[model samples]
Target: METVRVNLGSRSYDIALTHGATANLGAFVRAALPKTSSVLVVGDSNSWPHAESIQATLTRAGLRAGSAVVPAGEASKCLERLAGLYDALYELAADRSTAVVAVGGGVIGDLAGFAAATYNRGLPLVMVPTTLLSMVDSSVGGKTGINHPKGKNLIGSFHQPAGVWIDLAFLNTLPAREFISGLAEVVKYGVILDAAFFAYLESNSHAVRTRDPGALLRVVTRSCRLKADVVEQDEYERTGLRAVLNYGHTFAHAFETCGGYGTLLHGEAVSIGMECAAQLARKLGLIGDEFVSRQTKLLDALGLPTAPPTRWPADDLIAVMRRDKKAVGGQMRFILPTRLGEVKLFDDVPEPLVRTVLESAVSR
Candidate 1:
């Protein structure tokens, strides 16, 4: 197992990455949260078996373990499902010590983590992210929330998990489109922070696409550590440093919201959003065609979309973007790239330029 520690003083935790099956999940949980006596495993329908296995392991370790399963999809991250999760916790008689293990993708993490954060004023939380997207990004950030009708992640909290357990075996079961969707976030890390890593992805694209164990290990390990470095500096968005992680999210979230949840996967929106942001950056003279070409080539090689779905009209997307959390005082902000390896948040973006990017939606 490879371990990356998120050093956040008292809120610090370890992200454990393993290739396939492993024993001693109980030990992993106990090591980080010895005080926990019981656990409520929250998973979606597709990941229930993994959740069942986790519950049995924890129960065998002499801790009470229970599980709740919701239908698998973006729709699951809603007020109705969140209320159901609260009911599950109450039925399990879970307390502050009874850790909530989010077993599945990003949706489960957000739903369960929100419950753990609010129920009984916060319960110990453990993340068992089974999807590549959640494994590399959402699982490590401690930013948990359910989506509201108006926006994505509109209701949430900064409740860090006690530990994160990642087993890449889950990738074997993920659909091809879902797996490709995940590469978008992986690409975002390279764009916003690591130049070498971007070049590495370009060179080793075949290996990662083939699911070579070594490439995946390096990819997930590096992505988690890069995020940890940022989260350590600004656990909340107070310092504006963490906002860089939202590089393409401003446009992406709007795409997701306008299409309604599940129309486009989160990472797909991120992929298209990155392209829009890059185009907007070019208009602002932050970078030229070369920078945009590099990102477009990588996104294409990974089978990600560079433009929002045509059905998502520019005006509708604009209205949604305006209501996005990143828009302060009804003004838009974006994390635009200065070059290949870094991104800067700009609050002075013009609406017409953004509209042009949205209206153009021409895939390279």
Candidate 2:
């Protein structure tokens, strides 16, 4: 197993990336929260089996462990599901000493993390991400929350995990579409922070899509390191430096909200969002035509959507963007790429230009 550290002083944690590390999960969590006497293993429908297995592993390691499963889908990330988690913890008689081990994808990780952060005045969290998206992105950030009707992740908190335990073995059963969906965030890391990672991806797209083990290790490890670097600098997003990680999220969240959460998977929405953002950047003369084509081709190669999947109203999308947390004075802030390896946040974009880009994104 390879380890990367999110150096947050006292709140620091380790991210373990390996192909078959599930057997040691108990030891990992035990080391992270040694005082914990019990664990609440949370997962969704698709990942329930794995959650149960993890429970057994923890129990064998001499800690009391129980498991709960939520319906698997984006819709589950809501107030109702969150309340259900709270009830589960209550029934479990959990306390600060009981670690909440999240055992599925982003939805479960976010929901369980939020529950761990709020229940009994907060509990330790150990993430066992079972999806590519969660492994490289959500699993490390300590960003926990559910979705709101108005926008994505509108209700959330920053309760960094005690540790993030990742095993690429979890990806063995991941669906093809879901696997493809994760590449969007992987691509985002390249577009926003590292050009070489982007080049490496472009060169290894075939291997990545084929699930080559070596390629996946590089993909997950590099993505985690890049994200950790950002989180280390701005743990609570106080500095605008962390916003660079939101390169396509403003447009992506609006797409997700307008789709009523499940219509477009977060990765699909982000792919489309990056397309619009790239177009907007070109319109502002920050990049040339070649750059836009390069980005679009990469997404296309990854089999992710490059345009809105449906005809969401441009005005409505903009309205949702305005309500985004990063917006200032009713204006949305966009993380626009200025080059292959760098992005910048822009808060002064004109509504007309935004409208034009949104209008241009219509699938047909």
Write model 1 residue lDDT over 1-364, tens digit each, in one string: 7899999889889999987654578899889999999999999987888888888888888889888999999888899999998999999988767999999999999999999999999998999999999999999979999988787899999999999999988888888899889999999999999989999999999888878888988999999999999999989988999999999999999888888888899999999999989999999999999989999999998889897666577788888877888888888889999988789989988888998888787543
- The TM-score between candidate 1 and the true structure equals 0.98
Query: What Cα-based lDDT does every candidate model obtain?
Result: 0.90, 0.90
Worst 10 residues of 2 by lDDT: 355-364
Provide the global lDDT of candidate 2 against the true structure: 0.90
- Candidate 2 structure quality by residue, lDDT tens digits, 1-364: 8999999998999998877768888888888888999999999989998898899999998888877789999788889988998888888888767989999999999999999988987899999999999999999888999887766788989999999988898898999999999999999999999999998988888999889999999999999999999999998898899999999899998888888877888899999999999999999999999989988988988898998878898888889999899998898899998999999999999889988898988842
- Each candidate structure's count of clashing pairs: 0, 0
Q: After superposing candidate 2, which stretches have Cα over 4 Å from the reference? A: none
